[model samples]
Target: MQDLTKEPRLSKKQYLVVASMLFGLFFGAGNLIFPLHLGQIAGHNWLPAALGFLVTAVVLPLLSVLAISAVHAEGVYDVGRPLGRWFALLFMVLIHFTIGPLFGTPRTATVSFTTGVAPLLPKSWETGGLLLFSALFFLAAFLLSYKERKITSAVGKVLNPVFLVLLFFLFFVAYSHALGNPNAQAATTAYRNGGMSFFNGFLQGYNTMDALAGLAFGVTVVTAVRGLGLKREGSVAKVTAKAGVMATGAIGVVYLFLIVLGSMSVSHFKPSAEGGTAFNQVVTYYFGTAGHALLATLLTVTCLTTAVGLVAAFAQDFHKHFPVLSYVQWLALMAFASFLTANFGLETIIAWSTPMLMFLYPFCMVLILLSVTAHWFGRDPVVYTLTVGFTTIPAVLDMVASFPAVVSQSSVGVALTHFRDSFLPFASLGMGWVVPAVVGLVLGLGFHFASQRRQAGAATSNDVQPDNAD
Candidate 1:
């Protein structure tokens, strides 16, 4: 058997191809809505807000890609090796569930129900229609998935182009009309917070979880590329990278455009709406009923596709790790679980996702950083554990602070919040962990290198011939 630990050489072209698939997997309509809302809030400050959003949206996602590439990770689990095998498995499972039924799937159902299904139904029929429609939607997705990845990939290719065109129509119409309007008001608080807009945007971007998900999805991209006959590791990496860059580039443009549209709407629309509602209002104002219908349909279909893809991807990963579990069983289990969660709706899903991201993103980010710097750190497990542990502590504390309601009742939660309040990092926005994590990495590396030098000196002393003469 080939040693799994040995390095695999994927060509740059292959990397680009893998990258593209990864990008496609990462971007979705749900990712589009929030920033637009932010823009509406930020108004003139949209630039800084956009920058912050881009940090999580663009830079963080890119960092995830770089992290996976650095370690030549086979999957997200592999990247989390610093945390240990059981921890890796737990992390993977958490990611899959979060992006699948518990968070993303439910959001898909809710978004579609509100935007697509609800419009057609009377208010009384809305709830029933939502449940029914989501069931049918996920069922169709599961059936389509049975056709295999190539078919799925082909559909993705077609859907992506169509989705892009639809999005173009969306932005173009909004931009033209908003610009033509005789008068428009600027957004409230567009340029306040003393330049915290970027930071806020970054936090908002984290909600996408695309970068975190990418580490998991990398295996999918690699597997798909390999099936396409680019067996060489280096070639695969190159192709994936190209594809990834293109895909994310597309997503970035779309996100910025949507944010601009949101900013423009602040002049005419209410600021109370979140991401999905903001999108609906923009569509209604620009295109009227017909435009709303089109937007809803597109979002529903996209979310359905995303849900199917995620469930299928998770099942595939699970089977690989646990050979005893048949693929079909895993798929069915994930689909059923997702179906149950999809009933919760988009708003609720997003609400609950925050603390989870708080708890997990730091670890995910540290993994990337460590993997990239593995060479400098001597690939030592000790260094990995130290950086990750130190970084994760504050992250965990922040997670507790952010979810006061959830944690307030539990002993663990109570303890965490009590301690966290005293910590400067926890008192800040959910990101008190970033600075300390970086410091920990630096300190840990310093100690490691010093110890290594001391060991070297001792070894040299023992080997020296002068000892025999004495």
Candidate 2:
């Protein structure tokens, strides 16, 4: 095997480009639309809401990159290996599915079409239009990914700057003239006030799906850093951390601007079922006919780049796990799956995927937190096991409680859902897992410390007394 540690060093300019690529990769799909909706709905509470959204959406995803660096593991499963091999494999597969065919990948195509292409077509052509658009979109992503080695240069040097320029232009225009009253609604019942908006925002961040996707993206980032010629593990980690920070900062700025736009528009505009629709309204309100063309171009490129990244990540990881399938074969499979699922449309995808996200997000959050902070407990496997295992109890219940009406209506499901909601702290807020996770962390640490003390005492006794007598 080649020694990655001995790779050449990247110039500052090269490193910055990598950072740009990371931002663009994470900045697609829901990245653009979610916060605008939050802003529109949050109104006077936008500050608290944005803060909460940032914690999970921006903070956690950056931490994920650091977590990858902390472990120096090549893939996400390395973080999960402490739980045992089989469980790790299960987790890797589920996250890959979530970030791939089942949700994330398909979303890229759907969002691209809905936000970028759909407006150009008549309502009568919505279904066929999506099918045709997805076919072309996924095909382009597949072609770009076929030469995955160039992804960093291609995206960082090319696509990312275009994305940034257009987005910044939108922000400039938005700031130049306020579209609606700066003061608007307080919040919806879910976010009755500023303080409560934190948890609501946290849960809503799950919809961004970046936290899950970000873990998978770590490999892409690491590989890019390595490609920059940084050979030593520490050097690679250092660069990855720096790039993570830069990317996080960029994403934060983007989210803040978009959220502000969303918040200000609340007084004059109602949020559409899809936030993209609201985006169009705001853009057109200012730029008129030109905004439509600019938006379609912006959204299409953003979504295409994200799809390329997801497809590459999935195919590369899948090939590693199942070498019998070539990378191209895996890419072909992923692209086909994305093409098929995207035709189902954006709203339907969100509807089916949200329940799954509710189940898996808590698990991802615990994993990211533990992996990044593992050094505090000396990287003990028991601590990882305990924290991750205990979290599942509430996560599963939250799943049951939040399950779409289809499954929740079953008698047994209904009874269990009630038990969870009635018994768990924060269950009503869909955060039942938080308290249990903390308890699990405490207990795991307690066990670890006691065991260490017992071992130390036994060693002391042996040292003090017995060789001669024996």
Candidate 3:
């Protein structure tokens, strides 16, 4: 392999352009619209929700980029080394499936359907229109993916900027003119849980799946900057970090602006709409039908790009691991799977994704911590296993509790309610998992180093005794 750390460097202009590309790659309008809906529903609790949303949506994604940069890691699984290859591959496959067809592709269809198809259709034509529109949607995605280089870049540069500029315009108008009262309380059962409400929003943000995607994208950013003459791994890391920081800052600004817009709009707008619906109303209120149309187009394009990039990556990764499968074959399989999954619609996708995110986010966070902490414990597997084991227990219970089917049980479902009831720590909204995991990591490291010292001492003592006998 090439010595990536020894390559050339990028200029300031190239760095910023790299950052812009990074921002565009991650910042789909679909991501933006969801927050507006979350905010409108959250109302006065928007702060907590927004804070939570930023963790998964912004912060973790940023860290994911850092994870790749820290080791010049090629992908998420590369960084998953401390966990073992098989474990990493299992995770990589799960992450790819979740972000690919299982949740992602269908989301593209649904978001595109609601934004593009639903607005023009009546109640009578809804179901058939959805089926027709999504079929055509993925079909287009399939065809365009065949000529990927041209379509991906064209959409990225042309359609993306237009969408972003229009979005800023809408946010500016909404924020400046204001809506109704800015101080309505959260009425939903989800928000009634107190401080944990914010965390719930945070975890919900993970469903966007951007953080995991960002890890994969770090390679793209590095490669792009490298093309511009930045070759050294350190330089690439520096540029990538700067670009990630810029992208995160931009996302943060937009999320904050939109949440405030959603919050202030409460007096004038009812929280009847879910996710993008409330957002579309706010857009239509300001930009009218034409504005809504433009937003729809942008979302479709944003989703298209995300869908294509995800498909391309999945195919490439699949081929890399199992060389017998060709890229085209994998792409076909993925698009087909995505088409079926997409039919499930956005509401269902979002509902099912929550539990999965709750389980994975902590694991993702732990991986990030371990990658950075590798040298501290001498990169010992025992330490890794101990910390991960501690983390998984609470996360597993949280996953079951939050599962869409069980979330409504009130007892965290029937028999499980007894489990949580007996386990007091699990009762406090699953935040109980965070502290113990951290403690386990700390204690595990201590034990790892202590054992290592004993082993080294015994080896030295044994060697010295041989000389004494001689």
Better of 1 and 2 by lDDT: 2
Best by TM-score: 2
421, model 3: CA deviation in Å? 5.0
* Whole-model alpha-carbon lDDT for candidate 3: 0.72
lDDT of 1 by residue, 353-419 (tens): 7888888888877887787678787777777777877887788787776664756558888887767
Off by over 4 Å in 1: 1-20, 179-191, 404-418, 458-470
Name the lDDT of candidate 2: 0.84
lDDT string for model 3 (284-392, tens) is 7887878667777767777776676666667657766767888778878888888888777778887887777767777788877777667777778888888888888
List candidate 2 segments past 4 Å from native: 1-7, 184-186
Q: Which should have the higher lDDT, number 1 or number 3? A: 3
Better by TM-score, candidate 2 or 1: 2
lDDT by residue for model 2 (74-168), tens: 66788788888888888889988888998888998888788877887899999888888899989998988787668897788888899889988
Clashing pairs in 2: 5-231, 5-232, 6-231, 7-229, 7-231, 8-229, 40-262
